[model samples]
Target: MPSIHDILTKAVALHNGGQPERAAALYRDVLAVEPAEPHSLHLLGLQMRRAGCEAEGIALMARSLLLAPTLAPALFNQARALQDSGRLDEAIAHFRRKLEVDPNCGVTSIVLGNEALARGRLDEAERILRRAAALEAGGAFASRLRRALERVTTARGIARDAADPSLPPGLVVRGAFRDSSGYAHKVRQFVRHLVDAGVRVRLVDLNHGDVDNLPDGQIDPLLHTLDRPVRAKAVLSFTTPLVVEAVPNLKTINYTVFEALDIPPLWAAHSRRHDHVVVATDSSRRAWLQAGHPADRVHICPEGVEPLEPGRVAPAAILDGTGRRLADYRVRILNVSDLNSRKNLEGLLRVWLRTTRAEDDAALLLKAGKGDGASGSIRDLLARLTAETGRTLGEAAPLFLVEGKLSDTDMMSLHAAATHYWSMSHGEGWDLPMAQAGAMGLTLLAPDHSAYHAYLNGRVAHMIPSHVTPALDGYRGRDWWTPDEAAAARLLRAVIDDPDGTRLSAREHLLEHFSWRSAAHRLIGLLGGLDAL
Candidate 1:
């Protein structure tokens, strides 16, 4: 094996040659061999920033700066990382420090001027950019410096996602309203918060079709903002990347998610027409960045969950296969899902077989959505399991799978009928049903991967183990995993054996941490001042 110095030298060469992924692997190798190598630390941090892992990169570079305070590259990279993260004060402070180290650094002056301009420090911006203009008269950054100078007097104060749309000036939310697909559900949920947060949002119903469980006509007149006219300079589109429109003068922010290991390159390419990409989780953000979206233009704003529907009580009863009502079970473990491949229905069924017995008073309530021959698909899954494991679902505990067209009120009733909600999904991108279940006081159990870590902690729910596997199907997210069926089985038996009502007590924490009001206010803050929204 080469020494750490030799490995680092090669890593730096690769890093400079624009092979960050390969260079990053080598830098990690250097860290593994000599954990506190400051050079390796800072270089790896820069690579991380390039990949849009700003927080991680900043932390790594901070550590490197602490270890090697005199490292100029560390300071420069750390300053860039902070700038990429939109921390104007810290970023400007670091840029000033770098300029102090070398007052004649034209690139440093240009960036400092630009940031100062963004902070509305016109005099400071003009002075710095003038110096930069003189120093880099005909250099590579001449045109960029010229642009920065032109914007100095015109620049405004920084907001997360400022109202810089090229059209007149307003925000329009474009998404499908007449559907209840995952995309539609999330869009509707976000609109609820945005409107509640006091935004005068206009709507542009996409009306594209994938799933249409929701009825036509406005579900909530206030939520739809149905009264507002549709004419705006900015659009917050909650559709997939393929439908991204290249409308000039409109600042488009694509609000979407990905459960797969990655997004299609074509989708990623199309999304570039939009101004920014906002997602609900860091994993989703990383996927967009990895698929070639700009690091600084991608961001995370976590989704919130509330009761299934406020003030609407579910129907009184739900019958299981054995004619016993769902309420009859001592412990009703629920999973509201569709027949999607990534849901890992096979893993769920296997766990159900491995753990519970017919004598057990617990039941698994699957409120699966109706799809094309969705009922027959369950039979096919059971048949596959029987051939593979030589055991049937009947030999285990009662499995109650509910597949039907349910109204929102009826769905709330389904949640009311369950004691617990669980999933062994291969992946997720902010699971709405699971979040709703947890919010409704269902003792939640989920695998330790993807968006599950966003809310559920050990104190709140039983978290199962997960192992990284090849991305199922063709998901373009960084990684996916298979939940440990054995571990899930063990948890199920423990919960079944000892029913603890205290598990439901943590539901309040979920509400407190992920309220619609709070999440909406955050989105509002990003768009402009809360009052501006």
Candidate 2:
């Protein structure tokens, strides 16, 4: 029942699976049967190019596209060849042609924009880059294009400021919130949304934190510059009338107003000094009101998550194809968080130790991105728990540790691979990874509090069923920690025993509630309110 298309699909799969030489043969066989198949032609052509047959691959791809002008991939491949071949004019035309066919294509627009910049067509490059950014929410290529545009715009701003001398004053929001540890990358979402919605927005990130323990691309490298203080003082002198505070760093001190901007009136004071202020939280509304800044002057917009496009390539190709399931070996429960004291990893550890059924088939997998700061303490606690639990569970039941910060794409892939996503955080500002897991259709088990609860309908995710008891200090905080060792045993028994039916339903709940497109629409509505501002 398989057609030539199916066979070609398999060939593409083989190519993706790292057997490109074998894939090349299958592709050739397909071409022998149907010489004009554009998809196979384009893909094989790309493979050929990558394998060092540039001229032959370029000619084949160009011929394939000429035979089928509507094939976007072919057009893209042809543009790549043209660019490398030093035919800029032809490359630009074909790149734009790809976008004309598929306006949502990000790669084409990026290349076209980059070429435009290379040719000194700044305005055209800017327009194309912005459009491309909207299409692909997050990617290294898109990030590079955006940073390039920022550099160009900043240069122009400096030139204009020099000519005019007196400029329209403004404020730039910077700084991190208490719960914004893992979700710091989402700040770009806020800045981009504001820019696309017609607000003049600028981003200045030095990644001013310690690079020693931080993950790559998570923080800006410029922040650690030895001349940061001198540069900061200079920037402060430059933006005299315009203020910058309430942001993460104390960079621009020479500017007017040194107040932090979390909510409304607090934000409004800066807006009163300038034209507008950006607010990260709704609680800032009270601050703005107290500062006597009108609602119109303060822009209230939360950061957004732009969903990754469904991979153009299939998922089966990406997998190892060993065909193993959790039941075959130990069941791995993954918890993603930094190894920080505040994250409450200890509570989960305590719960794991008391559970009886977990002693047999379960292995706790903690994925920590941050360096091993408090890891010795955590390992010691985990070892103690394993010692107590292993009496019944056996010696093979100790927990395993895998520590490294994964990129957004790799993290999503891992979430798709996980048995269940667990979040035992004390609190989260946006909880981007949890939302991403939901979007990836993974079963999530989380604490029922803070912004996590606000995003999920309470009935959806599994909450630990326990009433608040007094803390060790006898303080009045709610008891999220399980004191009754039996409670932990009961919770584990319920989750593991009903794995199939319960897990399927939990996945269904995620598909219904958390999605990238749905989040994007919500963001659009939020931006709509800024018209009054």
Candidate 3:
């Protein structure tokens, strides 16, 4: 005996609460009472879609919209269903019709912009997304609109660059090249390529941490242009996004990466001020997007492998207080990680202990350090993991730990020291060390997840199967990859058994497919796509 209004309200609540059958019954009751109840028809249509009757639902929703022409939600749902059903043109027509009906419909605008992007109309997509962003100013859809515009900007760049294969204007680069971290090396490589591509470059040194490595800074001296009142198009920062200070009136892009699913709060907050976020991998971009950054605003500019320089390569690791080299082992397996949980160094150790024995003619060269907001030593943790596994390192193959500051040449020497490189990382922005090792023609093994997939296949490098697991300490929100220790041990044994089977021309593949020059040009193109930054 409920009123039509009461019945409709109950139907909506039931529908939202996942009691679709009950909601559909109420919707039917409402329609029985008032045969032309548009809301009831609309709700009933949605229930039909949930029941796998997509065509019937679309027809009913159409009928409902015809009866009550201004049912915004009904129109939106019908359009979405049509889009899902592959009626893209019809779906777009419906979205455009929705804007005509509502005028300030941000969702419709977003949809239209996406359709334009799918149709390769980058300019149109940018215009629509911009308009939508302004319309939904400070609302829930603003982030989405901003992200859409970022994509349109990138798409425009790709389209233009493909047509005209010329480099854009040089960018003003600002990043930490003085440090001995992976970040510093990535910036150096990027700068080297940018300068080589005939791009006008200016460098601003940002020494973030430990600058005490021997053979101090000299990053392609051609970047030392002292142009005042910097008329450069954009400022590209290569340090942590958390530390980037935005340039006034210039588009600021913070080039950074993270090795986990969850980004630190401060870093996420700081990146908001920048005009765009450029990450080395999609994994890094996802961390920002998952943390509520605009998707389009964060773009992927993949890091590249540096081609090997044989004469310049130096050997750097010294083992167990003895001047023994990693080269001493017949099968030298190397892993570079720090004290960060996301590095999953413990996983690597577990694999090592389970796979190798005392007389196994193999050694694990752990080039360990402390970086990416990690403090504390790796010794205690490894000892604890070793103890918990009911095994002693003395009974297993040699586990040589190397924690020293090495120069750029020495770092290459460290890679040169190994016969193979392996990582069991939870995630990575772009594991530069892993790439560098592969470039040095070492047998590569990594988890089949995250940034590793960008370069490897079963044929190119051995893959450690992984599954979704709860992210450990520090990295909280999203789930991360956990390599199967047993499977990894098997692969480790398999590769060692047939060392010839591990014969992948990793150096050639990495250098050819992931060129530093190509990465720099794409970066330049991404900036040029933006509407006069």
Candidate 4:
């Protein structure tokens, strides 16, 4: 007894609320009373498609569109159904027809652009998406259009780069390649490997400020100065999309490293924009997968360390801040970190003071960088530690804070001076310093979890006994490991007592599996495979 309008409204509510069968019956009743009702026909067709009757759904939608020739929703739905069925050409035509009926429909333009991209028609996709962006300006649809447009632009650039003869024919490496960050070191090492392998390579410096300060033979200005299109068979982007917008037509790979248990949702969103992702370790890959990234798209590419020359020894004497030589300590333990709470420096201090005696002539060399935003200053840390331990700074406590920039040679020399290297970090993306120390033949005492598991093991390094605990600092809601102080103290004693055997084992393991040469070979193979695809 209900009016056709009331019936259709109830059917729409039922359909949206997941009562498709009931909705279908109501729609049928509406159609029976008014057979030419376009809305009823369109709603019923969508319900059929949801129920897996693609052919029936398409036929119903076609009939509805015939009755109401300018029904935008019906036209869009028909195009979507065709797309889902893999009939891209037909789907694109129907989408174009839908846009003709509703020229301002941002959704249709986005769909059509995606269809064009999937069909390898980059030019058409870019044109359609740009139009969508203009029409949907200053709204959520505009944001989506912008993202799609970036993808299209990047695709076009890559295609043009591939065809350009002036640029190198091999892979293009783009990142802050000359910076002091761990990512920079990784990029430089990988690029070196590619060059050694006879791969025609090109390096693009994303951090333009660091260009002038780079070491000699580091930056190839000739390649950067070329006036041709930016082309490469593949692009290994170590930076983010915001830094190097697009690399058209190439298999773009994002090399990401996160030093936490959960990858920030924002980072995960950015990562999804790439064709593939390369993480530093299996743990990083797992974190990304847990963050809802597709498993097949994320890969484990563990970082490598530069092997030290044979017979490299610790410096016998290094200058203190006052430029005075202070190398008379019996055993020196070293910790190099960014001085954040996540590094567990407080815990390390507590364990060190409790385990070793001041009379043991043992010195703890704390080579720390400027603190993170949340961390207090080094003077504050020293004051707090002094208050906690009731030991005065200089002669009373064996902790010495070393803060300054050290060149690569100086860093190697510093490593040589240390009797042992230690870290009590809650987590790490790759633990670059620990790997470097191990490669330099320094015995390492660190937590066994996180990225350390990729290279460090019982045979090579002292694996601190630890248990998973709720993360501290800004990393709340996530989990990180806490090393048992008692176990760490014991390992510290073990390393100091048998430094020779421990260092030998650590060095052999690093040289065998974690060398830069091996990592480069693996990267080349992966690039070649992606190119073939």
Tell me the tens digit of each residue's lDDT in model 4 across 235-303: 777864323334545666878776666675545655666788888898888888878889988887778
The candidate with the higher lDDT, 2 or 4, is: 4
Who wins the lDDT comparison?
3
* Per-candidate local distance difference test: 0.73, 0.52, 0.74, 0.73
Q: Is candidate 1 or candidate 2 better by lDDT?
A: 1
Q: Estimate each model's TM-score.
A: 0.65, 0.46, 0.63, 0.65
Q: Which runs in model 4 stand beyond 4 Å of their true positions?
A: 1-159, 165-168, 208-230, 240-244, 312-317, 321-326, 370-376, 394-397, 494-504
Write model 2 residue lDDT over 1-533, tens digit each, in one string.
56888888889889889999989888888888899887778888898887768778988898788789989878877887776554556877888898899888887787777655434356777898888788776765656666757644643443344244244322232332111244344534443444454444334442323344334454443322211111110121112121232211212221112111222222233345433444333434334545566676544433334444444212211211244233333345667776554355766776666553433665555666544444576667677766765633233334545445454445565554456666655544446666665555555676554445445654556654433333332111212222233544465556665656556324444444444434434544543443211
Residue 146 Cα positional deviation in candidate 3, in Å, after optimal superposition: 35
- Give candidate 1's error at residue 326 in angstroms: 1.4
Residue 204 Cα positional deviation in candidate 4, in Å, after optimal superposition: 1.5
Predicted structure 4: lDDT: 0.73
